[model samples]
Target: MENNLLNLRMTSKMLSRQAKRCQKEENKELEKLKKAISAGGTEEARIYASNAIRKKSERLNITKMASRVDAVASRVQTALTMQQVVRSMGITVVSMEKAAQSMNLEQISAVMDKFEQQFEDLDVQTGYMEGAIGGTTALDMPQDEVDMLIQRTADQDGLELNAELANIQAPQYLPDEAS
Candidate 1:
Protein backbone atom coordinates (compact mmCIF):
# COMPACT_ATOMS: atom_id res chain seq x y z
CA MET A 1 0.00 0.00 0.00
CA GLU A 2 2.76 2.45 0.90
CA ASN A 3 4.62 1.74 -2.33
CA ASN A 4 1.46 2.15 -4.36
CA LEU A 5 0.68 5.43 -2.61
CA LEU A 6 4.22 6.70 -3.23
CA ASN A 7 3.89 5.86 -6.91
CA LEU A 8 0.59 7.66 -7.10
CA ARG A 9 2.06 10.77 -5.43
CA MET A 10 4.99 10.77 -7.87
CA THR A 11 2.62 10.40 -10.81
CA SER A 12 0.55 13.32 -9.52
CA LYS A 13 3.62 15.52 -9.24
CA MET A 14 4.75 14.61 -12.79
CA LEU A 15 1.27 15.35 -14.15
CA SER A 16 1.25 18.72 -12.39
CA ARG A 17 4.61 19.61 -13.90
CA GLN A 18 3.37 18.63 -17.37
CA ALA A 19 0.30 20.78 -16.87
CA LYS A 20 2.39 23.78 -15.79
CA ARG A 21 4.60 23.38 -18.89
CA CYS A 22 1.52 23.26 -21.12
CA GLN A 23 0.16 26.37 -19.41
CA LYS A 24 3.40 28.26 -20.02
CA GLU A 25 3.39 27.25 -23.71
CA GLU A 26 -0.24 28.29 -23.97
CA ASN A 27 0.55 31.68 -22.45
CA LYS A 28 3.35 32.25 -24.96
CA GLU A 29 1.04 31.36 -27.83
CA LEU A 30 -1.62 33.71 -26.45
CA GLU A 31 0.91 36.57 -26.31
CA LYS A 32 1.79 35.98 -29.95
CA LEU A 33 -1.90 35.84 -30.84
CA LYS A 34 -2.52 39.15 -29.10
CA LYS A 35 0.36 40.84 -30.93
CA ALA A 36 -0.86 39.49 -34.27
CA ILE A 37 -4.39 40.71 -33.61
CA SER A 38 -3.08 44.17 -32.68
CA ALA A 39 -0.98 44.41 -35.88
CA GLY A 40 -4.13 44.84 -38.00
CA GLY A 41 -3.59 41.95 -40.40
CA THR A 42 -6.85 40.02 -40.57
CA GLU A 43 -5.51 36.78 -42.10
CA GLU A 44 -2.50 36.51 -39.78
CA ALA A 45 -4.63 37.47 -36.77
CA ARG A 46 -7.18 34.76 -37.65
CA ILE A 47 -4.48 32.09 -37.95
CA TYR A 48 -2.79 33.10 -34.69
CA ALA A 49 -6.11 33.23 -32.82
CA SER A 50 -7.05 29.76 -34.06
CA ASN A 51 -3.68 28.29 -33.03
CA ALA A 52 -3.87 30.00 -29.63
CA ILE A 53 -7.39 28.69 -29.01
CA ARG A 54 -6.27 25.15 -29.86
CA LYS A 55 -3.25 25.42 -27.57
CA LYS A 56 -5.41 26.87 -24.75
CA SER A 57 -7.83 23.95 -25.13
CA GLU A 58 -4.95 21.47 -24.90
CA ARG A 59 -3.63 23.26 -21.80
CA LEU A 60 -7.07 23.07 -20.20
CA ASN A 61 -7.21 19.33 -20.91
CA ILE A 62 -3.77 18.83 -19.35
CA THR A 63 -4.86 20.83 -16.30
CA LYS A 64 -7.94 18.62 -15.95
CA MET A 65 -5.75 15.48 -16.18
CA ALA A 66 -3.44 16.90 -13.51
CA SER A 67 -6.41 17.60 -11.21
CA ARG A 68 -7.58 13.97 -11.62
CA VAL A 69 -4.11 12.67 -10.82
CA ASP A 70 -3.97 14.79 -7.69
CA ALA A 71 -7.38 13.51 -6.62
CA VAL A 72 -6.25 9.90 -7.07
CA ALA A 73 -3.12 10.63 -5.03
CA SER A 74 -5.26 12.13 -2.27
CA ARG A 75 -7.48 9.04 -2.21
CA VAL A 76 -4.45 6.76 -2.11
CA GLN A 77 -3.04 8.74 0.83
CA THR A 78 -6.34 8.42 2.66
CA ALA A 79 -6.36 4.67 2.02
CA LEU A 80 -2.80 4.37 3.31
CA THR A 81 -3.75 6.23 6.48
CA MET A 82 -6.77 4.01 7.01
CA GLN A 83 -4.67 0.93 6.41
CA GLN A 84 -2.21 2.04 9.09
CA VAL A 85 -5.02 2.66 11.57
CA VAL A 86 -6.58 -0.75 10.85
CA ARG A 87 -3.23 -2.50 11.22
CA SER A 88 -2.63 -0.80 14.58
CA MET A 89 -6.12 -1.70 15.75
CA GLY A 90 -5.55 -5.31 14.71
CA ILE A 91 -2.41 -5.42 16.81
CA THR A 92 -4.29 -3.92 19.73
CA VAL A 93 -7.06 -6.51 19.39
CA VAL A 94 -4.56 -9.38 19.42
CA SER A 95 -2.86 -8.00 22.51
CA MET A 96 -6.21 -7.52 24.21
CA GLU A 97 -7.19 -11.11 23.49
CA LYS A 98 -3.92 -12.41 24.90
CA ALA A 99 -4.38 -10.33 28.03
CA ALA A 100 -7.99 -11.42 28.41
CA GLN A 101 -6.99 -15.07 28.17
CA SER A 102 -4.68 -14.66 31.15
CA MET A 103 -7.45 -13.12 33.30
CA ASN A 104 -10.01 -15.46 34.95
CA LEU A 105 -13.73 -14.69 35.16
CA GLU A 106 -13.50 -14.48 38.94
CA GLN A 107 -10.67 -11.99 38.78
CA ILE A 108 -12.49 -9.88 36.23
CA SER A 109 -15.67 -9.90 38.30
CA ALA A 110 -13.75 -8.97 41.45
CA VAL A 111 -12.07 -6.05 39.70
CA MET A 112 -15.41 -4.84 38.36
CA ASP A 113 -16.99 -5.16 41.82
CA LYS A 114 -14.11 -3.23 43.40
CA PHE A 115 -14.49 -0.41 40.84
CA GLU A 116 -18.24 -0.29 41.45
CA GLN A 117 -17.78 -0.06 45.21
CA GLN A 118 -15.21 2.70 44.83
CA PHE A 119 -17.50 4.68 42.55
CA GLU A 120 -20.43 4.20 44.97
CA ASP A 121 -18.33 5.43 47.82
CA LEU A 122 -17.24 8.44 45.84
CA ASP A 123 -20.85 9.24 44.99
CA VAL A 124 -21.90 8.99 48.66
CA GLN A 125 -19.03 11.24 49.72
CA THR A 126 -19.88 13.75 46.99
CA GLY A 127 -23.54 13.85 48.07
CA TYR A 128 -22.56 14.35 51.73
CA MET A 129 -20.15 17.16 50.83
CA GLU A 130 -22.75 18.85 48.67
CA GLY A 131 -25.38 18.70 51.45
CA ALA A 132 -22.94 20.07 54.06
CA ILE A 133 -21.75 22.88 51.80
CA GLY A 134 -25.29 23.86 50.81
CA GLY A 135 -26.50 23.88 54.39
CA THR A 136 -23.67 26.10 55.60
CA THR A 137 -23.37 28.49 52.65
CA ALA A 138 -25.75 30.04 50.09
CA LEU A 139 -28.83 28.15 51.37
CA ASP A 140 -28.52 29.84 54.77
CA MET A 141 -27.52 33.28 53.46
CA PRO A 142 -29.68 36.19 52.27
CA GLN A 143 -29.91 36.73 48.52
CA ASP A 144 -28.07 40.07 48.64
CA GLU A 145 -25.31 38.56 50.81
CA VAL A 146 -24.89 35.65 48.42
CA ASP A 147 -24.69 37.99 45.46
CA MET A 148 -22.16 40.18 47.23
CA LEU A 149 -20.07 37.10 48.05
CA ILE A 150 -20.20 35.94 44.46
CA GLN A 151 -19.25 39.40 43.21
CA ARG A 152 -16.34 39.60 45.63
CA THR A 153 -15.07 36.16 44.57
CA ALA A 154 -15.34 37.09 40.93
CA ASP A 155 -13.46 40.33 41.52
CA GLN A 156 -10.72 38.48 43.41
CA ASP A 157 -10.44 36.00 40.53
CA GLY A 158 -10.44 38.74 37.88
CA LEU A 159 -13.71 37.40 36.41
CA GLU A 160 -16.70 39.48 35.34
CA LEU A 161 -19.91 37.84 36.63
CA ASN A 162 -22.67 38.88 34.24
CA ALA A 163 -25.04 36.02 35.04
CA GLU A 164 -28.38 36.87 36.73
CA LEU A 165 -29.53 34.15 39.16
CA ALA A 166 -33.10 35.51 38.84
CA ASN A 167 -33.18 34.53 35.14
CA ILE A 168 -32.62 30.86 36.05
CA GLN A 169 -35.90 29.09 36.84
CA ALA A 170 -36.03 26.24 39.37
CA PRO A 171 -37.01 22.78 38.22
CA GLN A 172 -40.77 22.31 38.42
CA TYR A 173 -41.89 19.37 40.52
CA LEU A 174 -44.89 17.41 39.22
CA PRO A 175 -47.12 15.28 41.47
CA ASP A 176 -47.70 11.61 40.68
CA GLU A 177 -51.34 12.41 39.79
CA ALA A 178 -50.21 15.06 37.28
CA SER A 179 -47.75 12.63 35.70
Candidate 2:
Protein backbone atom coordinates (compact mmCIF):
# COMPACT_ATOMS: atom_id res chain seq x y z
CA MET A 1 0.00 0.00 0.00
CA GLU A 2 2.81 2.43 0.86
CA ASN A 3 4.58 1.61 -2.42
CA ASN A 4 1.35 2.13 -4.32
CA LEU A 5 0.86 5.50 -2.63
CA LEU A 6 4.41 6.52 -3.46
CA ASN A 7 3.91 5.53 -7.08
CA LEU A 8 0.66 7.48 -7.18
CA ARG A 9 2.35 10.58 -5.78
CA MET A 10 5.14 10.29 -8.34
CA THR A 11 2.69 9.80 -11.15
CA SER A 12 0.69 12.81 -9.97
CA LYS A 13 3.82 14.95 -9.96
CA MET A 14 4.81 13.80 -13.45
CA LEU A 15 1.33 14.53 -14.75
CA SER A 16 1.40 18.00 -13.22
CA ARG A 17 4.75 18.73 -14.84
CA GLN A 18 3.49 17.45 -18.19
CA ALA A 19 0.44 19.64 -17.84
CA LYS A 20 2.58 22.71 -17.20
CA ARG A 21 4.73 21.87 -20.24
CA CYS A 22 1.61 21.47 -22.36
CA GLN A 23 0.28 24.82 -21.13
CA LYS A 24 3.54 26.55 -22.11
CA GLU A 25 3.43 24.91 -25.54
CA GLU A 26 -0.17 25.97 -25.90
CA ASN A 27 0.71 29.58 -25.04
CA LYS A 28 3.51 29.57 -27.64
CA GLU A 29 1.14 28.22 -30.27
CA LEU A 30 -1.47 30.85 -29.36
CA GLU A 31 1.12 33.62 -29.74
CA LYS A 32 2.15 32.21 -33.14
CA LEU A 33 -1.52 32.08 -34.16
CA LYS A 34 -1.99 35.70 -33.15
CA LYS A 35 1.07 36.71 -35.18
CA ALA A 36 -0.14 34.76 -38.22
CA ILE A 37 -3.58 36.37 -38.01
CA SER A 38 -2.04 39.83 -37.72
CA ALA A 39 0.39 39.31 -40.62
CA GLY A 40 -2.45 38.40 -42.99
CA GLY A 41 -2.84 37.85 -46.80
CA THR A 42 -0.68 34.72 -47.18
CA GLU A 43 -1.65 31.03 -47.60
CA GLU A 44 1.28 30.04 -45.31
CA ALA A 45 -0.05 32.23 -42.53
CA ARG A 46 -3.49 30.63 -42.82
CA ILE A 47 -1.97 27.15 -42.59
CA TYR A 48 0.11 28.14 -39.55
CA ALA A 49 -2.98 29.58 -37.81
CA SER A 50 -4.96 26.36 -38.42
CA ASN A 51 -2.08 24.20 -37.13
CA ALA A 52 -1.68 26.37 -34.09
CA ILE A 53 -5.37 26.03 -33.20
CA ARG A 54 -5.15 22.21 -33.49
CA LYS A 55 -2.00 22.03 -31.36
CA LYS A 56 -3.56 24.28 -28.70
CA SER A 57 -6.61 22.02 -28.59
CA GLU A 58 -4.37 18.96 -28.12
CA ARG A 59 -2.44 20.69 -25.32
CA LEU A 60 -5.68 21.63 -23.52
CA ASN A 61 -6.80 17.98 -23.72
CA ILE A 62 -3.51 16.86 -22.15
CA THR A 63 -3.89 19.44 -19.33
CA LYS A 64 -7.42 18.13 -18.61
CA MET A 65 -6.11 14.53 -18.54
CA ALA A 66 -3.43 15.56 -16.03
CA SER A 67 -6.06 17.19 -13.79
CA ARG A 68 -8.02 13.88 -13.83
CA VAL A 69 -4.89 11.97 -12.81
CA ASP A 70 -4.36 14.34 -9.88
CA ALA A 71 -7.98 13.89 -8.80
CA VAL A 72 -7.58 10.07 -8.78
CA ALA A 73 -4.43 10.37 -6.69
CA SER A 74 -6.27 12.56 -4.18
CA ARG A 75 -9.10 10.03 -3.84
CA VAL A 76 -6.63 7.19 -3.31
CA GLN A 77 -4.89 9.20 -0.57
CA THR A 78 -8.20 9.79 1.19
CA ALA A 79 -9.00 6.03 1.05
CA LEU A 80 -5.61 5.16 2.54
CA THR A 81 -6.10 7.63 5.41
CA MET A 82 -9.54 6.17 6.19
CA GLN A 83 -8.09 2.63 6.13
CA GLN A 84 -5.51 3.61 8.77
CA VAL A 85 -8.19 5.11 10.99
CA VAL A 86 -10.33 1.93 10.78
CA ARG A 87 -7.32 -0.32 11.59
CA SER A 88 -6.53 1.74 14.69
CA MET A 89 -10.17 1.52 15.84
CA GLY A 90 -10.09 -2.29 15.47
CA ILE A 91 -6.90 -2.51 17.55
CA THR A 92 -8.48 -0.38 20.26
CA VAL A 93 -11.53 -2.70 20.48
CA VAL A 94 -9.27 -5.75 20.74
CA SER A 95 -7.21 -4.19 23.55
CA MET A 96 -10.36 -3.25 25.47
CA GLU A 97 -11.72 -6.84 25.16
CA LYS A 98 -8.40 -8.31 26.38
CA ALA A 99 -8.38 -6.06 29.43
CA ALA A 100 -11.92 -7.13 30.33
CA GLN A 101 -10.78 -10.79 30.55
CA SER A 102 -8.89 -10.15 33.87
CA MET A 103 -12.01 -8.84 35.63
CA ASN A 104 -14.67 -10.62 37.82
CA LEU A 105 -18.04 -11.54 36.28
CA GLU A 106 -19.83 -8.49 37.67
CA GLN A 107 -16.93 -6.25 36.72
CA ILE A 108 -16.84 -7.90 33.31
CA SER A 109 -20.53 -7.17 32.82
CA ALA A 110 -20.00 -3.55 33.78
CA VAL A 111 -17.00 -3.27 31.47
CA MET A 112 -18.96 -4.91 28.64
CA ASP A 113 -21.80 -2.42 29.14
CA LYS A 114 -19.33 0.45 29.07
CA PHE A 115 -17.72 -0.94 25.94
CA GLU A 116 -21.14 -1.29 24.33
CA GLN A 117 -21.97 2.32 25.08
CA GLN A 118 -18.57 3.45 23.82
CA PHE A 119 -19.09 1.41 20.63
CA GLU A 120 -22.48 3.07 20.15
CA ASP A 121 -20.85 6.48 20.43
CA LEU A 122 -18.16 5.35 17.99
CA ASP A 123 -20.86 4.20 15.59
CA VAL A 124 -22.49 7.62 15.68
CA GLN A 125 -19.12 9.29 15.11
CA THR A 126 -18.37 6.87 12.25
CA GLY A 127 -21.65 7.83 10.59
CA TYR A 128 -20.65 11.49 10.79
CA MET A 129 -17.18 10.71 9.45
CA GLU A 130 -18.64 8.81 6.51
CA GLY A 131 -21.05 11.64 5.83
CA ALA A 132 -18.19 14.16 5.83
CA ILE A 133 -16.03 12.02 3.55
CA GLY A 134 -18.89 11.10 1.20
CA GLY A 135 -20.02 14.76 0.89
CA THR A 136 -23.63 14.06 1.81
CA THR A 137 -25.49 13.41 5.06
CA ALA A 138 -28.72 11.66 6.00
CA LEU A 139 -30.78 14.29 7.75
CA ASP A 140 -33.08 12.78 10.38
CA MET A 141 -34.93 16.06 10.82
CA PRO A 142 -37.39 17.43 8.29
CA GLN A 143 -36.26 20.51 6.33
CA ASP A 144 -38.63 22.86 8.15
CA GLU A 145 -37.59 21.53 11.54
CA VAL A 146 -33.94 21.88 10.64
CA ASP A 147 -34.55 25.44 9.50
CA MET A 148 -36.35 26.27 12.75
CA LEU A 149 -33.52 24.73 14.78
CA ILE A 150 -30.98 26.82 12.88
CA GLN A 151 -33.10 29.94 13.42
CA ARG A 152 -33.34 29.26 17.17
CA THR A 153 -29.58 28.75 17.41
CA ALA A 154 -28.95 31.92 15.46
CA ASP A 155 -31.37 33.89 17.67
CA GLN A 156 -29.60 32.58 20.78
CA ASP A 157 -26.36 33.96 19.36
CA GLY A 158 -28.05 37.29 18.49
CA LEU A 159 -27.63 36.78 14.77
CA GLU A 160 -30.05 38.11 12.18
CA LEU A 161 -31.12 35.70 9.45
CA ASN A 162 -31.37 36.83 5.82
CA ALA A 163 -30.62 40.38 6.85
CA GLU A 164 -29.08 42.60 4.22
CA LEU A 165 -25.97 44.66 4.91
CA ALA A 166 -26.30 48.40 4.89
CA ASN A 167 -25.19 49.99 1.62
CA ILE A 168 -22.65 52.67 2.38
CA GLN A 169 -21.80 55.14 -0.37
CA ALA A 170 -18.17 55.89 -1.13
CA PRO A 171 -16.89 59.40 -0.39
CA GLN A 172 -16.64 61.64 -3.44
CA TYR A 173 -13.18 63.01 -4.25
CA LEU A 174 -13.03 66.79 -4.77
CA PRO A 175 -10.41 68.50 -6.94
CA ASP A 176 -7.99 70.98 -5.27
CA GLU A 177 -9.23 74.62 -5.34
CA ALA A 178 -5.84 75.74 -6.75
CA SER A 179 -6.26 73.35 -9.69
Candidate 3:
Protein backbone atom coordinates (compact mmCIF):
# COMPACT_ATOMS: atom_id res chain seq x y z
CA MET A 1 0.00 0.00 0.00
CA GLU A 2 2.84 2.38 0.78
CA ASN A 3 4.35 1.55 -2.57
CA ASN A 4 1.03 2.18 -4.32
CA LEU A 5 0.74 5.59 -2.63
CA LEU A 6 4.26 6.47 -3.69
CA ASN A 7 3.53 5.48 -7.28
CA LEU A 8 0.35 7.55 -7.28
CA ARG A 9 2.19 10.62 -6.07
CA MET A 10 4.86 10.10 -8.70
CA THR A 11 2.23 9.68 -11.40
CA SER A 12 0.51 12.92 -10.33
CA LYS A 13 3.81 14.76 -10.50
CA MET A 14 4.49 13.37 -13.97
CA LEU A 15 1.05 14.39 -15.22
CA SER A 16 1.57 17.90 -13.85
CA ARG A 17 4.92 18.13 -15.58
CA GLN A 18 3.43 16.97 -18.90
CA ALA A 19 0.54 19.44 -18.68
CA LYS A 20 2.97 22.31 -18.05
CA ARG A 21 5.02 21.34 -21.06
CA CYS A 22 1.94 21.21 -23.30
CA GLN A 23 0.85 24.66 -22.10
CA LYS A 24 4.28 26.06 -22.80
CA GLU A 25 4.26 24.67 -26.34
CA GLU A 26 0.79 26.03 -26.95
CA ASN A 27 1.83 29.48 -25.76
CA LYS A 28 4.88 29.47 -27.99
CA GLU A 29 2.81 28.53 -31.02
CA LEU A 30 0.28 31.26 -30.26
CA GLU A 31 3.00 33.86 -29.94
CA LYS A 32 4.51 32.84 -33.27
CA LEU A 33 1.14 33.11 -34.97
CA LYS A 34 0.56 36.58 -33.53
CA LYS A 35 3.95 37.81 -34.69
CA ALA A 36 3.40 36.48 -38.20
CA ILE A 37 0.02 38.18 -38.43
CA SER A 38 1.39 41.52 -37.27
CA ALA A 39 4.50 41.60 -39.49
CA GLY A 40 3.24 40.07 -42.75
CA GLY A 41 1.76 43.20 -44.36
CA THR A 42 2.59 42.35 -48.04
CA GLU A 43 0.01 40.33 -50.03
CA GLU A 44 2.34 37.33 -50.55
CA ALA A 45 3.52 37.36 -46.95
CA ARG A 46 -0.06 37.83 -45.83
CA ILE A 47 -1.10 34.69 -47.71
CA TYR A 48 1.68 32.71 -46.02
CA ALA A 49 0.75 34.21 -42.70
CA SER A 50 -2.87 33.31 -43.25
CA ASN A 51 -1.92 29.69 -43.74
CA ALA A 52 0.19 29.77 -40.59
CA ILE A 53 -2.69 31.31 -38.68
CA ARG A 54 -5.03 28.60 -39.86
CA LYS A 55 -2.60 25.90 -38.73
CA LYS A 56 -2.15 27.60 -35.39
CA SER A 57 -5.88 27.87 -34.90
CA GLU A 58 -6.22 24.19 -35.59
CA ARG A 59 -3.59 23.55 -32.97
CA LEU A 60 -5.28 25.85 -30.52
CA ASN A 61 -8.54 24.01 -30.98
CA ILE A 62 -6.53 21.09 -29.59
CA THR A 63 -7.30 22.64 -26.25
CA LYS A 64 -9.74 19.78 -26.21
CA MET A 65 -6.77 17.48 -25.87
CA ALA A 66 -5.36 19.57 -23.04
CA SER A 67 -8.71 19.70 -21.33
CA ARG A 68 -8.98 15.94 -21.61
CA VAL A 69 -5.57 15.53 -20.06
CA ASP A 70 -6.48 17.84 -17.23
CA ALA A 71 -9.70 15.95 -16.59
CA VAL A 72 -7.82 12.66 -16.55
CA ALA A 73 -5.29 14.09 -14.12
CA SER A 74 -8.04 15.18 -11.81
CA ARG A 75 -9.64 11.74 -11.95
CA VAL A 76 -6.30 10.08 -11.28
CA GLN A 77 -5.79 12.31 -8.26
CA THR A 78 -9.22 11.37 -7.00
CA ALA A 79 -8.49 7.70 -7.63
CA LEU A 80 -5.27 7.97 -5.64
CA THR A 81 -7.17 9.42 -2.71
CA MET A 82 -9.70 6.64 -2.95
CA GLN A 83 -6.95 4.05 -3.13
CA GLN A 84 -5.49 5.36 0.10
CA VAL A 85 -8.86 5.12 1.76
CA VAL A 86 -9.31 1.61 0.43
CA ARG A 87 -5.94 0.64 1.80
CA SER A 88 -7.01 1.76 5.25
CA MET A 89 -10.23 -0.13 4.89
CA GLY A 90 -8.19 -3.13 3.83
CA ILE A 91 -6.34 -3.05 7.11
CA THR A 92 -9.61 -3.25 8.95
CA VAL A 93 -10.68 -6.10 6.75
CA VAL A 94 -7.49 -7.95 7.45
CA SER A 95 -8.01 -7.58 11.18
CA MET A 96 -11.62 -8.64 10.93
CA GLU A 97 -10.74 -11.59 8.76
CA LYS A 98 -8.16 -12.67 11.28
CA ALA A 99 -10.69 -12.45 14.06
CA ALA A 100 -13.20 -14.36 12.01
CA GLN A 101 -10.96 -17.39 11.82
CA SER A 102 -13.01 -18.93 14.62
CA MET A 103 -16.21 -18.43 12.63
CA ASN A 104 -17.53 -20.80 9.96
CA LEU A 105 -14.85 -21.59 7.45
CA GLU A 106 -17.01 -21.18 4.32
CA GLN A 107 -18.33 -17.74 5.28
CA ILE A 108 -14.92 -16.33 6.15
CA SER A 109 -13.44 -17.76 3.01
CA ALA A 110 -16.12 -16.12 0.86
CA VAL A 111 -15.58 -12.68 2.44
CA MET A 112 -11.81 -12.90 2.13
CA ASP A 113 -12.10 -14.04 -1.47
CA LYS A 114 -14.29 -11.10 -2.40
CA PHE A 115 -11.84 -8.64 -0.87
CA GLU A 116 -8.99 -10.31 -2.73
CA GLN A 117 -10.83 -10.03 -6.04
CA GLN A 118 -11.49 -6.33 -5.52
CA PHE A 119 -7.87 -5.69 -4.68
CA GLU A 120 -6.80 -7.48 -7.84
CA ASP A 121 -9.09 -5.32 -9.95
CA LEU A 122 -7.75 -2.16 -8.35
CA ASP A 123 -4.18 -3.28 -8.96
CA VAL A 124 -4.83 -4.10 -12.59
CA GLN A 125 -6.41 -0.73 -13.18
CA THR A 126 -3.43 1.01 -11.64
CA GLY A 127 -0.99 -1.00 -13.70
CA TYR A 128 -2.88 -0.40 -16.93
CA MET A 129 -3.13 3.36 -16.32
CA GLU A 130 0.51 3.62 -15.34
CA GLY A 131 1.64 1.86 -18.48
CA ALA A 132 -0.57 3.98 -20.73
CA ILE A 133 1.06 7.22 -19.54
CA GLY A 134 4.69 6.01 -19.56
CA GLY A 135 4.60 6.23 -15.79
CA THR A 136 6.24 3.04 -14.57
CA THR A 137 7.46 1.59 -17.85
CA ALA A 138 10.01 2.69 -20.46
CA LEU A 139 7.71 2.70 -23.47
CA ASP A 140 8.55 6.08 -24.99
CA MET A 141 6.04 6.00 -27.83
CA PRO A 142 3.30 8.16 -29.28
CA GLN A 143 -0.07 8.76 -27.67
CA ASP A 144 -1.96 6.66 -30.20
CA GLU A 145 0.39 3.77 -29.71
CA VAL A 146 0.06 4.04 -25.97
CA ASP A 147 -3.69 4.11 -26.23
CA MET A 148 -3.71 1.07 -28.48
CA LEU A 149 -1.45 -0.85 -26.17
CA ILE A 150 -3.66 -0.06 -23.22
CA GLN A 151 -6.75 -1.04 -25.15
CA ARG A 152 -5.23 -4.33 -26.19
CA THR A 153 -4.24 -5.08 -22.63
CA ALA A 154 -7.67 -4.25 -21.36
CA ASP A 155 -9.26 -6.46 -23.96
CA GLN A 156 -6.96 -9.32 -23.12
CA ASP A 157 -7.86 -9.02 -19.47
CA GLY A 158 -11.58 -8.97 -20.30
CA LEU A 159 -11.77 -5.58 -18.66
CA GLU A 160 -13.54 -3.89 -21.64
CA LEU A 161 -12.59 -0.58 -20.06
CA ASN A 162 -11.91 2.56 -22.05
CA ALA A 163 -8.27 3.34 -21.57
CA GLU A 164 -8.82 6.85 -22.90
CA LEU A 165 -11.93 7.26 -20.80
CA ALA A 166 -11.45 10.78 -19.48
CA ASN A 167 -14.21 12.68 -17.82
CA ILE A 168 -15.15 15.92 -19.61
CA GLN A 169 -15.51 17.75 -16.32
CA ALA A 170 -14.30 21.33 -16.18
CA PRO A 171 -10.98 21.67 -14.42
CA GLN A 172 -9.78 24.64 -12.39
CA TYR A 173 -7.69 26.16 -15.14
CA LEU A 174 -4.55 27.91 -13.93
CA PRO A 175 -4.24 31.25 -15.70
CA ASP A 176 -0.99 32.18 -17.42
CA GLU A 177 -0.97 35.59 -15.74
CA ALA A 178 -1.04 34.05 -12.29
CA SER A 179 2.31 32.38 -12.84
How big is the positional error of residue 174 in model 2, measured in Å on the Cα after superposition? Answer: 29
Off by over 4 Å in 1: 104-179
Better of 2 and 3 by TM-score: 2
For each candidate, give its TM-score against the true structure.
0.53, 0.52, 0.37
For model 1, how does the per-residue alpha-carbon lDDT over 1-179 read when each residue is reduced to its tens digit? 77876886687678768777777776777787788878877787777777777777876776666566555655555555556556655665565565568787765565556556655665665565555434433234567555555555565698755666433332343233265
**Taking the tens digit of each residue's C-alpha lDDT, what string does model 2 give over 34-133?**
7777778467567666766776677666656655655555556567666766776676677667667665676667666766766676667667555543
**Candidate 3 residue lDDT tens string, 1-179:** 44554565566566556656655665665666566667764564565556656655655444434444544554565476567759856875985677597687776777777777777777776666665555432334565555556555565687756434432222243233265
Q: Which of 1 and 2 is ahead in lDDT?
A: 1
Local distance difference test values of all predictions, in order: 0.62, 0.61, 0.58
Q: Which regions of candidate 3 are displaced past 4 Å?
A: 1-44, 47-95, 98-101, 131-179
Clashing pairs in 2: none
lDDT-wise, the better of 1 and 3 is 1
Q: For candidate 2, give the lDDT of residue 92.
A: 60
Candidate 1 clashes: the total is 0
